[model samples]
Target chain A: MSNRGPADTPPSEYEDEGRERLSYVVGLVLALLLTTGAFAVVWLDLLSGGAALAALGLLALVQAVVHLRYFLHIDLARSHRDDLLLILFTVLILLIMVSGTIWILYDQHIRMMA
Target chain B: MTLRGIVGLLAAAVPGTASAGSFLEPAGPIASAQFSHFGVISALMLIVIVPMFVALPIVLYRYRRGGKGTYRPDWEFNWGLEVVIWGIPVALALALGMALWKHTLEYDPYRALGPEPLVVEVVALDWKFLFLYPEQGVATINLLALPEDRPVTLRLTSGTVMQSFIIPRLAGQIYAMAGMQTQLNLLASETGDFIGRNTQYNGLGFATQSFTTRVMSPDAFAGWAEATKAQPAALDAAGFAKLLSPSVVSEPVLYGRFTPGLFGQVMARFAPAMVQGHGQAGMAAPPAPHQGHHHMPEAGR
Candidate 1:
């Protein structure tokens, strides 16, 4: 009943698989770079507390996108629309829960600090 | 009366029999703001909930066999109706989420609402609350005293397992984790006592872990502090050590002196090596933890 083609298709499918492997390798290297950048900032103590936090958060977000795009194969391609929408919805729910918990908890920390 | 009417009446009567846990009956600006948020959420929810409840009977009766409702067997879908159905909830949720975000910032406990708030260092033990008024050089077990209309800041952490500190009438709850610090800022709009408790479960003595909050005038608070300072049970290292015995404190006990950095020492107990020479010197600075930077392994994925 689904529109998905069979897993064992022709030479075209094999070409797609080869390209997928290349993207994975590229994503892994990029992820490493981002992670190292975040560590370098922290280990070197180049930035203050809030700046370091912001830098790390931004790097982490970019790293997440790298993983989703290359590793998970989520993209703006028409064929990926349904799966991307599902993943985006999942991300939306996670953003709500995680951000809400942090806001509610950390706000208290700010108010109560001596 | 219908079942709904009966339920409403029963809910109305609940206030008479209870000790009070109504966020609706807030006592301060924080609680009042929270209550407004609650109002918006409930009203929005009712826009969804009330329709579902009402439409159930209407749909069942109308669409039942041989009913007068217009039949549209050939229709697979209605684009306009579908758009409205999906769009309304999405729009509502987006708007509500933004409001929550705004309020979260506006009511940030760390934002310093007014003048320097009275700092009350709260240590959540297994079965009781140990409060230290560092400025007043006084401590109390299971009793909190705050001056009315003045912002009071609570810097809280757990000596035992993770717990949450909440005074339902005054402000929202925040977790008190072992080896980590959390905070809550609150104030009493009136002179009265409210119930505060550890909403987190931590082994056997969890049920008994609650405290009495007495909000008094400035003069009354000063009087209470002076009278508490004269109490015999001084909060030296030994007194604080005795508090960790894993038993419920039946009544509030006052201490003349609380050891400096006592709250930090309690947190450091869970991470002994993390707090090196400070604990031994009997004067550890309060827990202001810097989060560690760690990387996720690619292989794990």
Candidate 2:
């Protein structure tokens, strides 16, 4: 507990220079724009039916990726290999769950309709 | 599961209408099938769950302070054990998936049945069912009538939010999503009032989204249709708008005549022709070129 001293700490001046204040502002604005765009597609009923559904789905997928990359600071260089593998596995599992649900339900549709 | 929790779950799932000589049995085919599937899955999981519950105490006892057992600190993953663990589930899922696939196809309602059963277009709204008997040129809201012993095919859609079309005695609960059609086939063996309701929760009026399904003799059904047609006015576009207006506990209303191709018009309102063509392709004659060309890769390009 007694080993630390004020002179051993790095100055705050170096940290401030590395931070991109302008890029942070731009990233925030872009994120807001993407969110609004997603909302507009849904609110306007732009696609309707299957196309509309797929479009909204794609929008959500892209938005999730964007959030992970930018806001969460998840990237190839910054993240460990295990972290990237975990994310990939998680995405694969999610896809399997969603697609399997749709497939089984569609089959049920065919049967119930028959 | 505790007895209290299981009781609560059952109570929550079963409707209050069960004791009133309800139209359909609460624990019918779909409910039973789902229950059986869940039971099998849970039973298999219990193989691990129960053992863990038991072995956990034994492990704790053996590993206590100053315990007699020797410690092995350098343990690696057991590939054989992992293979056995994953293999058992994969095999079980494969068997279950196959069974589900076979049963699902066998019960397909829209497939061509004997003599092409009667068509009933059902629209579930806030708290009622609007049944349009296209072939009979009749429409009824909050009341469904069908002749006993005849296969009845229901084409279901929703006016707004998603709903589930469930007739417990007849078949499974299939979702009725807005602007999207889902089909169901059912036949009543005995003549009676069958309960039809929206199984999925929508909004405030969801509790009352129920209707009476009357299974009548062929002669009685014809008489009922005649009586309905004898009403003062027929259902038109404006009339439809009025019927579609969200309301609670709507009274049964019937119309002798409905606008021609009314269902198709409703289908087109939210979807392009190509979307409609997806379902109607094999059922009816090919859709018109201009309408069907909306999303087809060959034509859209």
Candidate 3:
């Protein structure tokens, strides 16, 4: 093992400057395609209601992954495990709070109408 | 001579001190239920809170340096201690969550309290409330008079910005937003004067946007409505336009006559699509013919 800490060590892929730039360009194109697809799905009335929602949600998820991998340089590599874990933990906390609130409020709404 | 004694004396001197505006001294069934709900929540919270406070000082003194408490420097996690520390809070949270869900459903503001409700169309304006009695063909600014023992169904909408309508002694607060209708059902149990107000801060005159809620016997209510209808003022389009201006109303203004379907017009102002098929200037929709039970024209949004 190397004496250098994880923070001090350079990522192997980033050592190739051309490949790093190519990854960014690829991520940008994919992000733009996904965004345009989402807009088209809504604007062109390609889908309605739940179907439309699901399609948009799928595109958004893809865009988020692309951004994370390219812009934020977060990935599933061994060196990036801490960053991924931190983000996942944050998402878990937000999901717990937001979903808990919605569940309670929606339950109340149904009961109120009943 | 004591501070507590002086406070007690002063409290006694103020007649009907907390009774008029406090949910703690509830004047209605809904408010009474809310008051008990509050009591229950507080008591449950105190079960956890009180112990923490009581243990804090005791723990500090017992574990202080050179004290009689056991000095276990090498001590690690104990399963029994861990369970106890986590278990109590988890159980308390579950209990509180269940209680909140149960009570929220039981006291829903939209749920009708009783039969044969007295309908009151409420419009929240800048620094004031306009209440229209569709059945009586009369309207009042900054005043809400209801017959005791009869449920009052309030269909609330805001004429300008968003506002919250609250009559603490009667029921809980409900939001009123421009172009959207919200409903609240409440029934005063006894004849008395309670305070009502817009709890949401909108602009400069928000502090003064309060109204007097008078609950009286059915017979007295009828008489008062008749007396009010005999007043000269009318809530015509021009008068309503004037009321739209931001100002604090010091005294309640009673309008004997008001334009029919005025409530719908106010709601339609924000949502023009609702009035699209009417084939008239949105403001000039034909006056609805007076019926025994005058239902406010629906703004089909």
Candidate 4:
């Protein structure tokens, strides 16, 4: 809508600063780096089993943060609280569903007679 | 027929198998515990279903066909009814979940049941069950006999596709997978013959893939084990290959002896081909560990 900001600055100057094109490109490059690093570690056999899994998990967490901060523009500011709250709720529900499914199925897998 | 006669008929009809195909007629310790769990869960589920079944008829009769059962057009929501509707199922689910959690840990498959439980390695082939008693150096087709009162652990794998090993009176089914091992621990409480089979279908012969489990006393078992050593059939690699040729074993087979460590090799035989899919051509597998063990008794061969 209106490209208006602080009275001290003109609208055109403020719009250029707030566009965040540089931040998004940086986020995209970082996400690709994390993904490629994880894949290379596995492909090159740098780590095996649990170590490789943990490394990939760490990289994925960082990439997710990059997406939220740069692409989705989520922040701690009061103006973005509603969107942040929705994301938090979605994550909570997702964690509950995935964990509950794993708990039930893994329990069956371990306890069933073979 | 009289009640006693009917009961007698039912018992005899299922002879050489457990009394029932369901856990209700459990013949072993594991199955008995599972049967109890089934009963508990069933009752908990009825907490939801039974009330609905009873209420449906009463509500229909009272409200329909001009039957007057005190009309309350102004009624909205009753606090007591609301609490009853939601509270009961939630309470039942919590109770059932706790029970499941406790028993699940208690009956974990990998836990060893006793100090010296008999180990039976099972391979589910096309339409038959091949049970190898590694410790005894014996193998059987379509027959699994064990000593009563001793815990038995079955290390199960599949030679072909996946199948489920189930002995209804003994324990619930667990899957048998190729190229991997799974475990089941159970113990017979009393001497009885029970039915065990592959519960998952693979091919045309799947329907008849049943086997018999005879639980004899320790003395009888020792005798049977000794007698098995003289069964005239030696379960060498060639004999085993013949066994793998996809035929239904209509009768029980006994191999007086099996090559030591044969079970491990049988498990390994699937690995390379499964991984490579080269039609087992010139795979050049090294001699199996059991094949090396054969020199212990026969010095010349």
- Candidate lDDT scores, in order, read 0.76, 0.67, 0.81, 0.76
DockQ for each numbered candidate: 0.06, 0.03, 0.07, 0.10
Q: How far off is model 2, as Cα RMSD?
A: 12.0
Question: By the lDDT metric, which is better: model 1 or model 2?
Answer: 1
lDDT score of model 3? 0.81
Candidate 4 residues B228-291, lDDT tens each?
Answer: 9878998888888887788899999999888876666666676543323322232122111222
Taken in order, the candidates have interface RMSDs of: 14.2, 12.5, 15.1, 14.5
Docking quality class, candidate 1: incorrect
Deviation in angstroms for A36 in model 2? 34
Tell me the lDDT of candidate 2. 0.67
Model 1: per-residue Cα lDDT at residue B28:
81
In model 2, the Cα lDDT at residue B239 comes to 77
Task: Sort the candidates on DockQ, descending order.
Answer: 4, 3, 1, 2
User: C-alpha displacement of B257 in model 3, angstroms?
Assistant: 1.7
Q: Give the Cα error of residue B199 in candidate 4, in Å.
A: 0.4
Top candidate by TM-score:
3
Per-residue accuracy of model 2 over B256-282 as CA lDDT, tens digit each: 878766665554555554333454443
* CA lDDT, candidate 1, residue B170: 86
lDDT of 1 by residue, B1-301 (tens): 2433444456577765246544556678888778777766766777678878999999999988898889988988889989988998998898889988999999976555578899898888878898999889999989999999888988787877788888887898998877666668887897888888989888888888889988899999999999988887777778778777798888988888877878767766664543443222211111224322211111011
The model with the greatest DockQ is 4
Q: What share of the true interface contacts does candidate 4 keep?
A: 0.00
List the pairs of residues colliding in candidate 3.
none
